[model samples]
Structures are given as C-alpha cells and as structure tokens.
Target: MTSDTPEARSALRDSASRTLRLEQQAIAALVERLDAGFDRACELILACQGRVVVTGMGKSGHVAGKIAATLASTGTPAFFVHPGEASHGDLGMITPGDVVLALSNSGETAEVTALLPLLKRMKVPLISMTGRPASTLARHAEAHLDAGVEREACPLDLAPTASTTAALALGDALAVALLESRGFTAEDFALSHPGGSLGKRLLLRVGDLMHSGERLPRVALGSPLRDALLEITRQGLGFTCVVAPDGTLAGVYTDGDLRRTLDQHSDLSGLSVDAVMTRPGKRVSPETLAAEAVRLMEDHRISALAVVDEAGRPVGALHMHDLLASGVI
Candidate 1:
C-alpha cells in the first residue's frame, strides 16, 4: 500500500538494509561461540556407525533439510525426517546406530520434544541446535549448538529471520569442518555429483571420447603425400599419424603443415610423408582425462592429437571437435 514517491522508496530500502545488517551481525556472532561443544557434535557424528538423522519443526525444519543435504554431499551420511511424521510410526526409520540432529529455535517444539524419550530408550545420541541453551531440548542433548541471535531481523520480532540465517551458517561451518577433517578432494566431490559438468571434468577419459580403428587417420612412413592427405580428409580430423615400418608412431602432418608445405613446393611426384611431417607430435594416452586433453591441445595450438601407447604405437586419435561433441569443452 506504499506509493511511488521517493520517500516511500527510501523507507523500503531502509527496511531491506536493516534486515541484511542484522543477519550479517548474527553470523558474525557465531565466530566466538564456536568452541569445544561444536567439536563434540562433529566427533559424535563422525564416530557414529550410521547416518545422521536431522529433524525440526517449522522454519527450523527447512534449515535442517538443507544441513542434511550439505552433509550428505560433503562426506557425512545424513538425511532429513519430519518430527511430526516421526510420531506416526516413521520413528522406526531411526535405529540405535544413527545420530540425531534436532533443530528448534525455542528448544521446546512439541512435535520435536516428544521424540526425546523414544530416542533415549533407543540409546541413540542427540545433538540439539537452539537459541536457548537452557531450553528442555538443548538440556537433554549430548552437544548443544547455540545458534542464538540478539533479536529477529523482523521489525515485529516474530518472524524467523536472522535466526534462520545464523542456523544455516552454523550448519555450513559444521559440514566444511567435517569435509576438511576427512581430507575430501575435488575428485571425491565429483563422485557424489556424477551427472554434471563437474563430474565430466573429473571422470571422462581420452579413450572414452577418442576415434579409433577405422576412424583413425594414419599413413605409413614411406607412403605418398597424397595418401596421407587422403586419410586426413577421410577421417576429417585435420591431421594424419605417420607410422614407421614397425607400426610405431613416427610423426604427424596436420592441415597447417599441409598449407605450409604447399606454399614451398608444388611438385610432389616423388615426395614421401616422412620428409614433411612433424616428428614426435604432441600426444596423450588413453588414460588422460578429456579435460587434460583439452588443455594439451590449447597449449600446443593444435586441433588434434595422436593417442599413443607405451610402445610408442598410435592407438587412436583425439580432436577438439570430439571434445566439443562430448560436452567436455
């Protein structure tokens, strides 16, 4: 119900600015509060023989779900369960081997608090996150992560604003700490995300995208220049591998070489490919990652490469076009 007047716009900006500032302050306050209690939570989860089951009510539920996902993706095995659902036989989903992470800003959410007795009987460990450390839920847990904020960013101090932001940031810090302690690598991260570009960069090998057998362009050492040119044209890789009499890679002649050679000599009646090829051309092995192959091609200013084996024999051919087609570019 505000107008388009400058005064109204300025008031709207002020509200947004205040909200951001309050949330920023909430996150900053968590820095010193991170102590041995945070370490205990990590140790409990890490030592557990099973998954970490996270549960919460209301806005805390949304934040709990995200925390579970981040933990699962990083290295910890975790999943989210609704507290309300837990009372309806879903409680059977949890077992003695699992650790529980319960979130409740007020620390006394009825749906969440009701699980305490059953969890205690099952002998499962509980880690509570709450704004009030002395609250019933926090007092019953093994580790209490204090996500308290001075006040809500909501002007009315009722809506979950700075509290949720603080909780989310604390969850992220926990996941990252576990990831570092586990020595997780990008390769490990890629394993968890195998369908995207990140996975392709780490998993796709040169052999997976190479052109081999009949599709590979190659010529013999004593072959005529016309034969090499024909193979290059037939394969459309813009280059041909010249093999020695022993079936080993001797050299390679590219389209660039062809253009340059033609500029210097027109009479090719007695010329062999060996005399005009680039010896020991830039090469790669089938085990190389397609991402690494892309770097090699770009580094050498060439569009194609000869895939060689340990015996110096050409096994296949790789082109920039092949990389592009495979979405590795």
Candidate 2:
C-alpha cells in the first residue's frame, strides 16, 4: 500500500468509515436493550453498602477498569479487580456488602466464570454484562445486561471492536444514570479531580489565591501620593487601594495613574492619594472563582484587583502573578 496510490487511500478511508458506522450501530442497538435489568443493576449499585467491584478478562477488563474509574469519580465508590487476580488472592477485596459487575463478551471466559461460585458463596450481588443473554454467566447473575452487537468491525470478525464499543457505551450509561440518581454535583466532581485544570477552575476561589492581611496594599483617602507609593512598593502589588475613614474602599491608585500624573507635570508636594486615584475600580468577592478573576482581568486590561466584602471593604488583593503562580492562568 503506497502512500501515493489512490487505491490505498480509498481503501483506508472506506475501512475507517465502515468501522465507525458499525460501532455506531452497535451502541444504537443497546438503547432498545435497556430493559428491567438495567434498573436492577442501578438499584444494586446504588443500594450497595460498600464499593462496586468490577471484574473481567482481556478487552473486557480494560472496559471494566474505565467503568470503575467513572463510577468512583462520579460519586459512587468503585474499583476494578482482574478476574485472574481474584482467583489468586484479590478475592479478599470483595466484601459481602459490595456489588460485583462482571464483563465477558461470550459470557464463558474461564477466568471470570471461575469466580461465579465464590461470589455466590459470599452472597455478593452479581451484575453481568455479556453478549449472550442465555450464557452461563448471565443466567447466574442477579441482573444481566445484554451488550450484544450484530457483528464485529474486523474484516475477519475475530477482533473485539463493535462489541467492546457497545460494552463501553453501556457502562457509561450506567455511570450517568447512577450519577443522576445520586444528585452528584460538579463540586463533588471537582473534589475528586483537584489536580487537573477542571479542579482548579471549580475548586479554587478568590480567597484561596488572594493576598490578605498585611500583604494587602492600602492607603488612607487623605494620604499623600508618596505614602501610597511606599505602600505599593512595600506590598509589591504595583498598586495601592485607597480606603475611607471607615476602612471602606474609596478608589485605586495604580502605576498607570502615576504615569498620567507625571505626564501632566503635576507637583508631588501637595497631592493627596484620592486626588489622582481611579474611583470604584473593578473588584471581586472572596467566593468568586479564580478563573472568573482571570476573565475580569483580561476583559478590563488590568493586572490587579481588590477583593472586597459585602460592605465594600477591601479584604484582600490579587495580582496577575498571583493567578499565574496558583496555576489559574
């Protein structure tokens, strides 16, 4: 198959298209197969006092692992254990209160089938996902999920392509249904993924990233420009918040204002901080998302903002560098 040949290119495109269509049809078939067994499977998992123990062999094992991860991240506690490993010693991980989800395309995989008797002896609830409903594994399961597909996408019909895709889709359906029934919120998802970008966006708040207490640069309303400059330098925020006698934010005096004052050739001897400050500058609440803070900074073309309370008092300060250091940028 030469890269320059039209015949080879056509063959590749046709093969990809056929594979995608076959997988699509396989997943579509699962929609009608959603019978009472699905509800029972969900009920078993939901009512499980312990975690959902997922087990399978070969390609089914890979799908089982992903399903277990999805379940754990979505609010249900679950983990994957290989059927082969279970026979060795990992069977001890399966407690009596846990629900077992077994995956086998033919439902006759030796490793998976070997565990049926032990699971029954332990009195653990079994939910089997197989292509053959009448197979031994399915017949023994408390609830059987039929994930059969019409045909494999492989030309030889030996590789597990369409069947695996259907099983993965069915597993996703179960995870989503369980998630909805448990009312799993995005905050809960964030708690499970606190190291990723999604976690930063959902879990990091303004208060977590803002500089408070002595780190907040501030100058009183009647203070001199020189005093505000000292506060800005001491705090190293490139700006200083102006506060009223009652400690409420009055305005903001940034380096930009200093440049403008210099352009006007204004004398620095008698200028109060309020005389050259930008009043009512953009501010954010402590509970605001750090991602939203980035948007506000980008939209207004500013580098710093005062974190204020409900009474308009400057409680904290945030700079662009703060966000960058916190990985919110």
List, residue by residue over 160-260, the lDDT tens digit for candidate 1.
99999999999999999999999999999889887778888999999998999998899999899999999999989999999999989999999999988
Q: Cα lDDT of all candidates, in order?
A: 0.94, 0.95
TM-score of each: 0.92, 0.91
Model 1 CA deviation exceeding 4 Å by range: 1-8, 268-270
RMSD of 1: 2.0
**Candidate No. with top lDDT:** 2
- What is the C-alpha local distance difference test score of candidate 1? 0.94
CA error at residue 162 for candidate 2, angstroms: 0.9
* lDDT for residue 145 in candidate 2, whole number 0-100: 98
Tens digit per residue, CA lDDT, model 2, 62-152: 9999999999999999999999999999999999999999999999999999999999999999999999999999999999999999999
